[model samples]
Target chain A: DVKVTQSSRYLVKRTGEKVFLECVQDMDHENMFWYRQDPGLGLRLIYFSYDVKMKEKGDIPEGYSVSREKKERFSLILESASTNQTSMYLCASSGIRDGGYTFGSGTRLTVV
Target chain B: AQTVTQSQPEMSVQEAETVTLSCTYDTSENNYYLFWYKQPPSRQMILVIRQEAYKQQNATENRFSVNFQKAAKSFSLKISDSQLGDTAMYFCAFMKLISGYALNFGKGTSLLVTP
Candidate 1:
């Protein structure tokens, strides 16, 4: 079975503070993604990495950036955390084929 | 750009009953994939079922099955003999086969399976 693990399950940060959410996958998949889920809005992509050091902006990448220094790890960074950034963040990894995506448990971020 | 829509925001069913969740998507691409994902209160997203556009046969996994209509761009999930463990937020997602783009998701439907 594939396993995608997130660094934190819950986090709290003050306004203007920088936040980091980490994700690691054991499957060595080539594709990794970050998304924020909100009520009635579903899951919106924030950033994605297809390979090491290669990143692309998703639909809602503002105020957020991502890092993929290694194949197994992907990190999402918030330049300046705001209350509006508070939401459940999810990380997913998939293979080159149209295989199913494996997702982390998600981190519920609270920006006060 | 592709978009997914789940018109039903909430639904309920008694245990051991059957329930269907509707999903529709708009996409110009002919080759794509549709999926149903379940996120329980624990916040873990679990892939329930998937359908390939080229295939006419619906996909089934145990008690979970999909009603895929490629021409209509519709993918509905049906859960038979629903259990309390089936209660969760269900999301429908779409992905283009050629573009390698991210999965487009719907707003999701909150399901309650009462015992």
Candidate 2:
């Protein structure tokens, strides 16, 4: 079975603090994605990497950045955390076929 | 640009009954993919079913099936023999089969299964 693991399941941080959310996939998938989910808004893509050292901005990428130093790992970084950024963050990985994505359990973040 | 829409914000079904959730999308790409994902209280997103736009046949996974209307750009999910575990937030998503593209998701429909 394919596995996607997130570094943290729950996190709390103060405003203006820098935060990092890590994701690792064991499937050796070529594509990795980060999305923020909220009520009524669904999951909005923040950033995605098609390959190591390659990244693309999604619809809502402001205040967020991504890093992909290795094929199996992708990280989401919040330069300066704010209360409005508190939400559930999800990481996913996909292969070239059918666009099937295997997702992590998700990390619930709260910015105080 | 591609966009997915789920008209029903909430739905209910009694155990062992059948229920359909509506999803419509707009996309200019000829070849793409559509999917229905379930996010339970566990917060893990699981793929329920998927349909390829180029295929005329609808996709089904056991008790879960889809009604795909290519011309209408509509993709609806039908859950039969619903169980309590079927309760979750169902999201319809669209993805272009191209590089540098990500899944565009709908607002989601919250389903509640009652005995």
Candidate 3:
């Protein structure tokens, strides 16, 4: 089975704190993505990396950044956490195409 | 911009019966991919089905099938003999081939299978 492991399932942080959400995939996929899932807005892409050191901004990349220093691991970083950034964060990985994505269980972050 | 829309916010189906969830997308890419993802309460998004735009035949996986109407830009998932395990949030997504291969997902439909 393909596994995408998220480091945290739930997180709470005070405002202005820097946060990190980690995701590791054992599939050795070339693409890794970070998405913010809200109630009505669905899953909006934040950042995605097609290679170990390459990254691209998605639709809602305003308050978030990503790090992909290694191939199997991708991390989403919030420079300064805010209440509006509180939502369910999902990480996914795919091969080279868009056939389908294997997603992590998701990390629900609550910024106070 | 490409968009995927799942009109049904919530749906219910009795176990052993069938249920169909509707999804419509707006995209200009002639050759793209459409997918149905199931996100259970555990929050793990699983790929339920996938369809290629160029293929005339709809894709199916076991009891799950898709009705793909390319002209209408519609893709719907039909589950036969729906089971309690089928209850989850279903999302319709469209994949773009430009820049990076990323999925643009709909808000999602919350499915409930009653026994």
Candidate 4:
């Protein structure tokens, strides 16, 4: 089955630490996205890539960066993790032809 | 920018009953798409149903259906004969080509199914 796979399901990070969250899609989709999900805030887009090495900032792009080195892998990076960044992170991919997105199971990160 | 609203933060319904989840969005675009996504305790988000603004007919998937009113910008989901497995956090999202297909989601409604 076509899949968007996140590297971690749950993560605990210390404040001020640099964190990396990885996502890989086997579907060869052209668009990849990272979103931060929180209670009452829904899902806020952090970054999205439409092509390899091409990234665009979403509404809540602050404190986050993304890298797309290959067609199937997109990585989200936290330059300096902070307590406020604690939330569930989701990764998704989609093809241009079909706007439907395939989401990964999500990564719940707890920053302390 | 589009904004989605889910006023009902929590809802409960007994098994075999019918329940509706309301979603409203604000957008000036004439052509777009609205979607309902379900996220159970497992945290795997699944697309429950979707409706294209241009289509006057509502979209349905088995026991799930949508009431899409383009004039009011309302997209409500109705679940018939609710089951225990239907309990989950339901999110309403809006998408448009102008926004690069990035979904604008509302604060989800937490639904519980009881016996």
Candidate 5:
């Protein structure tokens, strides 16, 4: 099975903290995505990267950034964690020609 | 931008019965894809089924099938012989032929299976 591993299953941070959420996929997928899931908001794309050193902003990119220094790893950064940023963050990856996405277990972040 | 809507926030079905979850989407693109994903209590998102817009026939997998009404912009999931393992949050999603194939997901319907 292709595994998408997240660094953490749960996280807590104080306001003004710089947060890092890491995701790694062993499937050698070319496309990786970060999504924020909340009640009533299903899942909103935060950012995505199609290749190394390549990234694109999704619908809600404010207060968030990403890095894809390596093909297997994609990282989501919170410049300054805020209470409103508290949500379940999901990491997903797919092959260039594949239609289905393989998702990580997800990390629930709580910002105080 | 495309939008997926799942009006049923919650649904329940008895074991061995059938249940349907509704979903609708809005988009101008003629060719696209729709999918159903299930997230169980374990929090892992699993692909349940997928349907291509150009295909007239609905997609099915084992006891899971879809009612794809392209004209109505509706893609619903019908689960037959409901099992407790089926209890989970089901999301309807839409994707265009874009480079990333990023999905536009609905709010999701929480389906609970009863004994």
Candidate 6:
């Protein structure tokens, strides 16, 4: 079965700490995305990569950075975690031909 | 800018009943795609149904179907014979080539299935 796997299901980080959330897909999809989900905000895109070593900022990219070193792996980095950054983070991937995305089980992050 | 809107924040339907969740979007583009995604308690997001702007026939998957009105820019999801496992957060999203392959998601509607 195809899958998008997130490295962590839940994480607690201290304020000002640098955090990393990793995602890997086995479907050989060309596109990978990271989003943060809040109560009322729904899912806000943080970053997405169309190919290895290429990345683009989404609507909510502040305080966040992404790394795509390989075709199947994408990492979301919180440069300096803050309390306001606490939210559920999701990773998704889709093929160039597929119109919909397949998402991984999300990571719930709490920045204290 | 393209924006997707889910007017109902919360909804409840009895098991085995039918329910419809409304979604509307704002976009000037004539060609695009609309999708409904379900996120259960496990937080695993899954695509429920999708409709293409140019297609007149609504898309259906199992017990789920969509009401797509291209001229009105409305795409609603209908769940028939709803089951307990169907309870989840449903989000409506819009995608267009102009949006750079990124999906603009709505606020999501929290649905509960009761016996």
TM-score of candidate 6 relative to the true fold? 0.97
| Predicted model with the maximum DockQ | 5
Give, for candidate 3 chain A, the lowest lDDT window spanning 10 residues.
A93-102
True contacts kept of each: 0.63, 0.76, 0.63, 0.53, 0.71, 0.51
lDDT of 5 at B72: 94
Error of 3 at B65 (Å): 0.7
Indicate whether candidate 1 or candidate 5 has the larger DockQ: 5
Which residue segments of model 4 deviate by more than 4 Å? none
- For candidate 4, the clash count comes to 0
How many clashing pairs in candidate 3?
A: 0
**TM-score for all models, in order of appearance:** 0.97, 0.98, 0.97, 0.98, 0.98, 0.97
Candidate 3 residue pairs in backbone clash? none
State the lDDT of candidate 3 residue by residue for B1-115, as single tens digits: 5888999999999999999999999987899999999999888898999999999999999999999999999999999999999999999999977646899999999999999
Compute the lDDT of residue B107 as modeled in candidate 6.
Answer: 96
What are the per-residue Cα lDDT tens digits for candidate 6 across A2-103?
Answer: 999999999999999999999999999998999999998899999999889999999999999999999999999999999999999999998884788999
Model 2 misplaced regions, further than 4 Å: none
Chain B TM-scores across candidates: 0.96, 0.97, 0.98, 0.97, 0.99, 0.96
Deviation in angstroms for A4 in model 4? 0.8
Worst 10 residues of 4 chain B by lDDT: B95-104
TM-score of chain A of each: 0.97, 0.98, 0.98, 0.99, 0.99, 0.98
Ten residues in sequence with the least summed lDDT for candidate 6 chain A: A91-100
Residue-wise C-alpha lDDT for candidate 1, range A1-112, written one tens digit per residue: 7799999999999999989899999997889999999999999999988889999889999999999999999999999999999999999999887558999999999999
lDDT of 3 by residue, A1-112 (tens): 8899999999999999999999999999999999999997889999999999999999999988899999999999999999999999999999887467889999999999
Which is superior by lDDT, 3 or 5? 5
Which one wins by DockQ: 4 or 6? 4
